[model samples]
Target: MESDKIIESILNDFNSFNIDDIPNIDLYMDQVTTYLNNKFEGSKRNDDDKLLTKTMINNYAKSRLLPPPEKKKYSKDHLILLMMIFYLKNIISINDIDTALSPLIKDYFNDGNNSLEEIFKLFIQYMKDTDDNQSIIDAYVKSNEYFSNLDNEDNKEYLQTLTLIATLTYECLSRKMIIEKLIDSLPKEENSKDKSDKNKSDKNKTDK
Candidate 1:
């Protein structure tokens, strides 16, 4: 399929979980897997694809990408963390995700004020309001226009594919560099505290 058409189809059928749609009660590992699978059903490439797995959740906790579940039950905070990781892992490193989200999680993971749930809801609303799909279409259109001078009609599709790949890679690299610079600008003490607390929390969970 043409890239633009595929992108349009995705935007038309984009499905994501709302804050109210997530369950209020804590869920066991299997339930968490089931919930994520259902929420991501529309985006899956195949019917047999698994959205989340027990092993992956365990790895996330072990890597400190997410907080440890209480009593083997995941809370809404955990769910929110997982959702953030799910989207980000495609384009960013796990270490970068840790650095980017550590402050938010440290301050708001379990707090009533400025909670992660609220933040997640805000993001959902922002996405709903944003013309991201149109922006993507415009970008693709502009890129094709810029490359329209290619006279070889037979290889136009191949060249267009290469151009798209190069453009997307450059875009990702630019954003990643900016994010890394911002992360480096954060106070060293704050980063240290976050790592220390994460280690302490992980150890306490293991010792229990």
Candidate 2:
């Protein structure tokens, strides 16, 4: 099918940000946004869509999803974290992103021996290794086959579309469940610990 060919070709040439494209020197806000915008231009649903903006970056920093930039300039590690945030924001909440990645930032954000760059490279390699284009093709085939017994020509198109939407939604939700479970497994943040301590203190005071 034409869609099968298109999906295969697109997945075969799936693009991801290259680590080498990151400059050694730090970047100002404009440069960071421009670089990401250019790199992910093709992924935009609309031509005028902005993937990353200064306001969004600032908000991320404020929300602690991104580490603060040094002297208003972002480092390579900052870019790497932003890249991760960009990819995950579409699938998960910003708070969840922080829960999932804050530990990494605390432990390995600046660890030269265990850098975020190395992790990013490994993740990109994993995507390449796990490219399963056939599964997607099968999904489309299944969507097309749904409601084949329905003889109403007018309802057939709508029913097939509904089946496809349902199938995709199921797949997305199933994967989201796994991701949320992994996030749930991460160590509680210091703030959460502090809150727990505060609650315990309050309880003790009430008992006294």
lDDT of each: 0.80, 0.80
Write model 1 residue lDDT over 1-208, tens digit each, in one string. Answer: 3877766667776634467888899999999999987877777888988777899999988876688899999999999888888877777777777778888888999788778888888888888888566666666777678768888864776677667777777878998888788877875534544768989999999999
Model 2: pairs clashing at backbone N, Cα or C within 3 Å: none
Off by over 4 Å in 2: 1-17, 145-162, 192-208
lDDT of 2 by residue, 1-208 (tens): 2445555556654544467988888999999998888766666778988899999999988766787898999999998898888889989998898898877888888687888888888988887677655567677778668767788966876776666667778988999999999998888876444656889999999999
Clashes of each: 0, 0
Where does model 1 exceed 4 Å of error?
A: 13-17, 42-51, 144-154, 189-208
